[model samples]
Target: MTSMTMLEAINATLRDEMARDDRVLLLGQDVAQLGGVFRATEGLLERFGPDRVVDMPLAEAVIVGAAIGLAAAGLVPVAEMQFLGFSHQAFHQIGAQLARMRYRSQGRFPMPVVLRAPFGGGVRTPELHSEALEAQFVQSPGLQVVMPATAADAKGLLQTAIRQPDPVLFCEPLRGYRLVRDEVPDGDAPVPFGTARVAREGDDVTIIAWSAAVHVARRAADRLAEENISAAVLDLRTLVPLDEAGILDAVAATGRAVVVHEAPFTGGFGAEVVATISDGAFYSLEAPVARVCPPDTPYPAGKIEDYYLPSVERVVAAARATVKAP
Candidate 1:
């Protein structure tokens, strides 16, 4: 076991993958000389050389479009959007081209590309740097969206994303890059998708979340435990291949649930969780499914980000309400 921060784990994973596979390469603005805006690619440039760690111009569409071309040719290209919000510029390539390549070719082409972007509020970044857009990206039929909440998951999930045949939108929480740390396993075994990790066990309500919201939910569960309100925390690590069975199981065990995420409440991924529970575990539900998220609005500026992101207090309140509902 190794203790490392989420950012360190991601850096190590990239280094390990690049070393393990000759075809694995990286490209993005500042990914070479600058070693990535957050240094997630630090030391990789010297180790892998410019041919693999090439830096491109500041064009999101061009970067993703190029990645599709690279993947179709045979090399595995990991494209990075400086901030996830900037991916709005590459929706054409991401949604239309890369996502549909395999289907468009009738399985003739393999879109083995990994798009990495960091998001979530905190650290006071500028506009478009902290928008939690996992819900929006997962709408593409063939694309997979993964968000890791811990250091260990960061290493394992990224390995899976890199090695997988389809395109994966790897959303790393900026708040957790340096803040979250844990014991990561020693091997290269990738963590499979469509599975949820049980962060805590309880029989009252299951608090479902992903990315930074998982931490928020876990903290809320701890608070609820003090008051004798047992709450289970389920981290839905991947949103695209959502763990429907895991969710149904958690809800059946607890008979109540509160979905949480950094995205807004209106159409956030939390709504999908509630619907999944309502659809699959309806008979077991003891109360109306609840959602804990920010209001339906654009991500706010840095000054008021705390008010915008879902807080542990809000999660606890929602869990308490779900538990008390008759």
Candidate 2:
């Protein structure tokens, strides 16, 4: 096993995947010369040449459209959107053509395309660079949404996303790119989708989260442990193919749940989790399923980001409320 950050693991995975399969190519703005904004694709151009490691124009739509064409033909293309907020510019191509290609083709095209983007607050990005709009992509049918919180999960999940037959929207947390670290296994085996890992084992309450929120949930669980409140952290690695059974099982054991996410509270992915718990483990719940998320307002600036985004304090408070609720 090699100890690495999420960004290093991603870069290694991309390099390995490209070397393992010649058809796997990469395309995005500044990917070739600049080696990507975050340098995730650094040194790839020199190794694979410009043909495989391409540098596209500053157009998210064209990047995705070209990837769709490549997938339809034969090659597996992993396209990057620089920042997730820029994906809105290519929503039509992604939702209309790329996602529905396999179903629309009637067993012809597998749509083996992976659309990657970096998002989530922290590190203080400018406008349109830090929005956690994962729920929006989850609503778009025919797309497998994946958000990896740790360095190991990031490597395994991205490997899985590239090898899979369906189109995947892989969301990487901006903060976690360099901040989160883990000992990643050497093998390139794909981590199965729709399977949630237990970040921490506890019987008092279940804290469900993905991507960056997983760390927050872990910190909150640690804080709750100080008060003798055991909180289990369930990391839902992938959102689209959600692990309903795992979620229900965790909540059933704990009898309480607190869902955490960075998106707004009104319609974030947390709502769907709460709904799942309500429908499957309603009787098992000792108190209402609580949620800790951002407000309905837009992504706050960096100055007030600590106050706006879901913090460990907020998650701890929500868990305490649920555990103490009558």
lDDT of 1 by residue, 155-217 (tens): 999999999899999999998999899999887858999999998999899999999888999
* Clashing pairs for predicted structure model 2, backbone only: none
lDDT (0 to 1) per candidate: 0.92, 0.94
Error of 2 at 174 (Å): 0.5
- In model 2, which regions exceed 4 Å deviation? none
Displacement of residue 41 (Cα, Å) in model 1 is 0.2
> Relative to the unseen true structure, what is the C-alpha lDDT of residue 230 in candidate 1, on a scale of 0 to 100?
93
Compared with the true structure, the alpha-carbon lDDT of candidate 1 equals 0.92
> Which window of ten consecutive residues has the lowest lDDT sum in model 2?
98-107
lDDT of 1 at 302: 80
